[model samples]
Target chain A: MKILVVEDEKQIADFVKKGLTEQGFLVELCDHGDEAMERILDQPYDAIVLDIMLPGRDGLSILKQFRKKGHTTPVILLTARSELDERIEGLNTGADDYLTKPFYVEELTARLHAVLRRSSDEQMSLLQAGDVSVNVLTREVKRRGESVRLTAREFSLLEYLMRSPGRVYTRTQILEHVWGYDFDPNTNLVDVHIQRLRKKVSPDKENPVIETIRGVGYRVCKDGAE
Target chain B: MTPRSFRTRVLLVSVAVSGLVLLGFAWWSWQLLEAFSSLSGLDTELVAGHAWLASHLDAVRWFRREFLFLFALGLVCVLGGSWLLAWYAVRPVDLLIDAAEGITAQDLERRIPQRGAGDEFGRLIDVFNDMLERLEVSFNHATRFSADAAHELKTPLTILQGQLDQALQEAPDGSPLQQNLGRLLEEVQRLKVIIRRLLLLSLADAGRIRVALTPMRLDELLGQVIEDVEILAPELRVIQELEEDAWVDADEALLQQAIQNLVNNAIKYNIDGGKIRFQLFRHEENLRFAIANTSEGIPEEDRRQVFRRFYRADPAHSRKVDGVGLGLSLAREIVRAHQGKLWLADAPEGWVMFVMELPEGAGDGAVESGE
Candidate 1:
């Protein structure tokens, strides 16, 4: 995937560019706002990482202008301020997603992939991890082709993990996505639910589909039951 | 002597001055009455010219009676007029006292209303409002500085965390270097958390808190919190008695942060393998949530100081615990923003309990008038 990163700070821009480059994406970096706008108008890229507080132009205006011109490329916003108005405004101005600063690049990568996948034509109706499958529309969970009954909360947890198998999610991320919490409670809430989920789905503690990365968090296997 | 109110002081001064004027008038009038009596004799000699002027004596006696009546009326007038003067002097002072007492640190923008006094009182109000203006400016400056510093700090933190995370991924699995990198990454994450929290606090300090309120079941949220606590501290005995349909319109994330901070404190200060109990119920128009745990006792003096920013009851043991001493303060701020009250409750001996009282269905509003 080709991506463009526009940030004024040299170190941050370089770090992000290098990270995205190492992740096998063609990343074009721009430091100045006018120059970034010039490049954005010149060509097409899969995604753009635009910083809100840029020198030449603020991210919101750029987004507004870009959207006004009718460009449909998926763009993710990076902002230093966690102000709600800015987040809502950015979303209203055609941003696919928003990430607050002080975030890990892996998180950015994950969000980028998620945004790209969402913008693609193929919409995911069913998500699967080996024998366990969750139909997003019907809200059904099946283990080994057998329909498994689960609580609404448990179903949401399973669906979130199954959507991005093999991608480890931190507890904070899980809390934010699954629990719809904007702030981290620093509790082992994800662990408790995942345990109950493991019992009902895999039932085998030794070869569970949900894997725990110690000192990290939880993830589902990309392919399981080997 | 008991301290008098400003109104009382002004009234006393006015009464004293008026009383002294009334006494001086009475003394001068008594002397004038005596002089008028002497004038009756002179009038009889100059005008009547008759050796027999007994009627002049009777007229003088009548004048003495009328003079006494007039003096009595003057005394009554002086009393009433003095009371009115006292009231006039005290009214503005009473208003100034009420307005001054109502002012809080959060509302430096508030000014005493002008009543066209054009006196010392008005100047006092103007001076007071000017001082408030300066205070607001300085306060805004301080808040903006911290917010700016926190904002600037994020880029560096993001780079550090991003690079460290990347290096950790490149290192071999289970290698010592990777483990070290993981530790470094955690520290970076901690820094990120501190900065985020600091920014939030700065917003709250500036009374610019933004919150999106939604109606949700408090019982359900508490159940989830307790479930997490059970996972983390399995050794501790936990009990929860939550009422059904205990709902509140609040910002979920903010309320959760407040509750989690309280629970974390309960666990942190608790004795090893101690018991914790949580209660949720509706009282009147408020929903009450009480969480208690068996803990090392707090001194009587320290109990009041617990909610103070960066207050640690036992400084020596603070290091043994992992916290930045902002948990309770932040929790309290969040609760206050929700128009709720959170306080350290008077618990049974050997227990530390916190009581959170929130109105059952408060509408969405800024945190402590912030934002």
Candidate 2:
């Protein structure tokens, strides 16, 4: 995937470029807001990471301009402003997703894939990691050719993890995506649900597919190893 | 004393003085007329005769009519003059009232225009303008502080979190460094939450938080919130008695935040396996929402303080809960911004209920949805 990251802060921009490049994505960086807009108008990229505070032009106006020209490239907003109205404004202005600063890079990649997947014409009706597969249209889960029953939340959580196998998701990210907005960050709700999902999908403890990234969040094993 | 009463007293005194003057003039005129008739040299016996008596009575009637006309004219003049004086005296106060009505949280720079120096109205205007100046300064200071604090704390925190994430990614799996980094990241996340909430509170205090109101279905919003609670705490039993098509003109996101905060609190502070009852219905001109949960009820004294920032009821019990005690305060602030009222309602048995009342007719113009 080709991605453009427009951030004024060089260090943060370098970090993001390096991370996305390491994730097997073709990454390009632009710092100035006007140049970024020119690049976006000039080229077609899979996704763009646009920062809100920029010289020449701010992120919101650029976004407005991009949408005004009818560019449909998926854009994720990077904002340092934690105000609720700003977030709402970003989303309302045709942003595919938004991440407040001090966010995890893994979260950025996951959101990128989610947005790209959402915008792509050929939607992956089924998400699979090894023997575990979930049918998106039918809301069905199967493990090793055997049917598995999951709750509504469990299904959504599994679907999210399976969408990007081996990618780490912070508890906050998972809670925001699976649960609705305004969840208590201190609750053990995510852990408990992940535990339930693990039990239901992988009854054999010795060969579990879901790997718990200690001190981080949960992830689906890339190889589905025992 | 009130200015109104003072004006009333002045009017009464004016009327009494005018009446006394009129009575004195009537008495003097009566004496003069008696002497004038004696000077006319009419015989006492002739004056007592029927024709003379009729003429004398006619003259007295004419005098009485002239006296009554003069007295009425004097009374009207006195009353009208007093009324005009009262109105003029209260003109400054009326101006002050108009100025006060225009002052709101959004516009604290408004001041009562000072007339001049040394007089009562002038002094009042000076004091009022001084107070407004101080208020505007403090309000600006607070607003700037919140914005600055958010910027100062969030930027560095973001950098710290990003660096920590990068370090964790490079560290070997299950290594001591990774574990330590994880702990640090958790602390960062917690700090981020605290910072975000603090910013929200400060914005609310400064009245800088803007609410974009739209018509929304209250029932649907409640259902979504309840569903979230169930997902988060599936063990707890939740019952919803939502009124059909309950609508409100609200900032949907903010209102949802408040409702979600209340539901989350009910779940967190609830007894193990406690039941939560959610109800919503229109009460007269208000749309009311009530959420009750089984818990060790808060004492009446603490209930008043619960809505205060950072005031936790039963701190020991709340130690296990995951908030900084701003949820209720923020919730109340949001409701207040919407011109609504939030209160702790009386509950039955061991249940503690919180009720929110939003004024009706706000959603009257909103498009109605069948579902």
Candidate 3:
């Protein structure tokens, strides 16, 4: 997949670009909105991570212009502000997703994947964790190329966990992402689901694919070899 | 009139009138003595004696005794009257001096009572009172404004420093610098918010708060907001319980701005990917909009001050959220201008809920008065 990162800070942009490239994604870095706009218009990008702050034209204006011109490619906004109103404005201005700065690179990569997968009509989407692959198109799970049976909700939760590896996912984030806004008020639903999923996916292993963060949330390591 | 003041004025006027009468009497007595000496019948010797009073003691004895006695009596009366006059004049002046001397910065509540003299002294007292009134007003506004501003500025500046320090201490040089840059940007954003709020409040105070009240549906506005924020953090569950077709008469831009602020506050202070429960319903004579997010409950003491300009409950949240603490304040002001009320309520599950109630036709006209 090809991604364009438009950020003003050269170092951050370079760091993000190098990380994504190492993860097998073609990455292009641009500092200004004008340059990013030119590249976006000329070439098709699978995803575009747009920073809200730029020198010439701000990210919001760029997003607006792109939306006006009917460019519907998935756009992730990297904003220094975690303000609710600014985030709302960014999203209303046609950004597909928004991330606050001081974020983990791995987290950004996961969100980028989620946004792209949801926005695009492509099937055969696969997210890999340690010795595990969760397929979106087939709704199937494979551990070391062995097929595993999982419930629908289990598969959905596993997919979310697999997308972002070595990053913490709070209980609230898990609740919102998995059960959405309307869910039962059980405190241990997440723990129960994780245990059930582990039973099916990581049999005969002391440490499972999902690792519990004490007093916090859950994490899975990147690079299935681990 | 107090009996003392009236008695003092009466005594002063009476004493001056008596002193003038005494002087007239003294002059009359001397004239009478001269006329008696000038009488024609067998008065040649007497007239000569009176004219040469120093030469003939027998002829001038009667004249000297009677006229001298009368002159002494008049002199005594004049002295007594003048003493009374001076006493009355100086008494009020002394009172004024004592009152003025007692006034100080610590006790602004003191007021000079109009002592019923109804003279220039009374007018002076009134002027002094008016001066104190103006001083109190300006002093209040200036102090409150500075306190709020200082509090607002300090948070962002402190945040910027904290983030930079954390970066230096914890993360690698490159990663932490990036984080520091992010925090610096946040501080700048907070400064902008504070300035905007301050300007708006001043404009409101100056009676220049202009409003373009329009008919707008609350549901649609919130729906758009939900749609927008959902894209920003798809992981966050924002449930909207908007009453459809609920209309309000308000300044369209300002109302939207207020809602945006409240939602932003909710999102910023909320736990990561926490549930944001939004509700819109009409209460008696007002439309209510409420947003609740799971938060560490605000202290009771801080609850009242939360709407005060530049007030923050937690330093960590204040630093991370990048707000200058004016969002809620501005929102409260806008609501008040619209003849509405804004308040914070304790929510279930240790959440903080911000509730805004807007009257149907508030701010349709200019806000009646600021205070």
Candidate 4:
């Protein structure tokens, strides 16, 4: 997928570009706001990663102008402050997601993948394999038509893994996704939580779903092997 | 001695002065009457005025009685009049006291309303409001300071973090270079957390914290917290007593963050195999939650400092207690921003306890909030 990155800080922008490029996405970089707007309008990319503060024109103003004109390409806003209204305002202005600054590129990549999948997929809120069905919008999980309850954290962990099934995620990636940016990476929090999820979902049996990849991380079985 | 009221002090001083003046005038009148009565020709010349004395021919005795009667009546009038005047003079000050009591640091806009009569009290109101304006300016500066510092600091941090993350990925798996980068990145992550929390605190300090209120279930939140506690501290026994259907209005994320902080701290500081008790119930018009955990309790001197930022009860500032820094302080700030209160409370020896109270709320929209 092609991605457009608009950031004024050249060094940070390079880092983002390199990260995305390493992740195997073509990245087009623009440092100036006016040029960024022109480039975005010039041609469409699969997704856009935007910075709030920019030269020539600010990110919000650009978002406003293009969104008013009905640009449908998914956009993720990158900002420095997790201030009170900035996140709400960005989402309301048609941005799909918001990430605070000093963020891991992997975190950004995850968000990019999420927004892209949301745009492309038919059922963005539902993950279904075998007898287990997960509903994101309603937050309902059913195993073989019997309702299964999960705590908030469990639900989040499940949703993150189920978003892209059959894909292995490392411990650090799981920590960033499930806990947050500030969670202690050294702790066995992810392992402990995953264990809880396993016990709750499949008691008295070796769980076919939520397969743990030894020395790597965990993944949801696409085939839901018994 | 008991502290005296300003009204009483004002009344006493004025009454004393008026009483002295009135008594002095009565004394002088009596002395003049004595001088006149002792005059040889006065009894015959002023007989009509001294008729009461004419009956007895002992005019001084009759003058003394009548003058003493007049003195008592005059004293009563002066005393009463002084009291009324004193009350009137201090009425404005009473209003001032009432207004001043309501002006807290969180609300500087609540100024003493101008009386508009350009009197002493009106000028006082103007000056007080002016001072509040100055205070409000300083408060706004404090709020802006955190956000500005975060903005300036994050750019370089982002660059550094991105480079480090990139280098770590490039480094071979489990190599020493990778280990070194991992450690550096963790420190950077820690700095980011500190900065974010500091900003949140500053916003709360200025009473600029923005909360989107929604009806939510504290029991559900507590249930989640319990699950986390179980996973994080399985060796520790948790005795939970939660009131059914007890709900509270909160910003779900912020409130959850606060409660999680409390739970995490309880686990982090507790001795292995310690017991934790969690309780939630409605009290009066508030929903109260209390947590008691077995731990090496805080010293009396340090108990009050638990909610202070970066204040570790350990004197050495020792190897940091794991988790996000300033757990108690941030939790308190979050609770305060919700118009709730969090406090360290007295507990049994060898245990620490905290209580959080929030205004009682209904959970009518809880299910619909899932959208």
Which one is best on lDDT?
Answer: 2
Tell me the DockQ of each model, to 2 decimals. 0.36, 0.30, 0.03, 0.34
lDDT of model 1, residue B98 = 82
True contacts kept of 4: 0.46
- Misplaced by over 4 Å in model 3 are A61-72, A81-93, A124-159, A166-207, A213-217, A221-226, B1-303, B306-371
Pairs in steric clash, model 4: none
| Segments in model 1 whose C-alpha atoms lie over 4 Å from true places | A1-5, A14-29, A34-49, A61-76, A82-97, A106-122, A135-139, A149-200, A203-208, A211-218, A222-226, B1-5, B30-99, B111-123, B314-321, B362-371
Global lDDT of each model? 0.77, 0.80, 0.68, 0.79
Model 1 agreement with the true structure over B80-196: per-residue lDDT tens digits: 776676677666667777887887767877888988778997888788778878988898788889878988898888788777766766665556776677678656756776777
Give lDDT tens digits, candidate 3, residues B62-137: 7556777766777677667666766765666667667777876445557777788678878888888898888767
How far off is residue B250 in model 3, in Å?
18
| lDDT string, candidate 3, A1-226, tens digits | 9999998776567667755775678998899988888888899999999987688888888889989999899999876532334566787788888875544455577778778778876553877777788777788899989999986668888887876565455554565456542111224667877888888888867658888755445767655632
Measured over the true interface residues after superposition, the C-alpha RMSD of each candidate is 4.3, 4.8, 13.3, 4.3
Each candidate structure's count of clashing pairs: 4, 1, 0, 0
For residues A109-137, what per-residue lDDT tens digits would candidate 4 score against the true structure? Answer: 76897798889984556677556778887
Which pairs in model 2 have colliding backbones? Answer: A102-B158
- What candidate 1 keeps of the native contacts, as a fraction, is 0.39
How many Å off is the CA of A142 in candidate 1? 3.3
Sort all candidates by DockQ, best to worst.
1, 4, 2, 3
What order do you get sorting by lDDT, best first? 2, 4, 1, 3
lDDT for residue A159 in candidate 1, whole number 0-100? 77
lDDT of 2 by residue, B161-240 (tens): 77887787778776778778877876776677667777877777767666767788898888867766776677899998
Candidate 1 chain B: 10-residue stretch with minimal lDDT = B362-371
